[model samples]
Target: MPPPGTFTILLFGPAQDRAGSGQVTVQARVECTCGELLRALGEQHPALAFALPAARLAVNHALVAPDHRPRPDDEIALIALVDGG
Candidate 1:
């Protein structure tokens, strides 16, 4: 089992395109904020950084505040909003 206070993040849609498919597990030492995680993900995937500023982040299937903190085993999903009416 993973160490205490650790969680896995799943990237989907444009976010997946940015962070790549598969799973990225982060340790507890890292701050579990949605925005900070997105920034780290963007760094890992430069394509994400290209347009990360406008991307939306979610935790546990719920839309969250910018400073939302993820709990252990929380599933984080990064979604890129499409602006096409």
Candidate 2:
């Protein structure tokens, strides 16, 4: 499990391209919600701002809504939306 007030962040596909990394950790209050995480990521990493709101927040491999609150040890991931013809 990660340290208190921190959560693992997994970035996939376009999110990875934007973040320049596939994995990261975010520090926040224990009550942090998915939307808060999304906003924090965008504020901290400008490159990811455009893709953040559209990205999917997943915990423990399950997709979650923006309002979903993350728990300790939960595997957090951001799956970017993709579009192709």
Best by TM-score: 2
lDDT of 1 by residue, 20-76 (tens): 665565554445677666766666556656656777666778878878877756767
Q: Put down candidate 2 lDDT per residue, 7-69, tens digits, no spaces.
A: 778887777876789977777788989988887777767887778766878889898988899
lDDT for position 69 in model 2: 95
* Candidate 2 TM-score to native: 0.82
Candidate 2: count of backbone clashes, pairs at least 3 residues apart or interchain: 0
C-alpha positional error of residue 29 in candidate 2 after TM-score superposition, expressed in Å: 0.8
| TM-score for each candidate, following the candidate numbering | 0.66, 0.82
Residue 52 lDDT in model 1?
68
RMSD of 2: 1.9
Q: After superposition, how far is residue 18 of candidate 2 from its true place, in Å?
A: 2.4
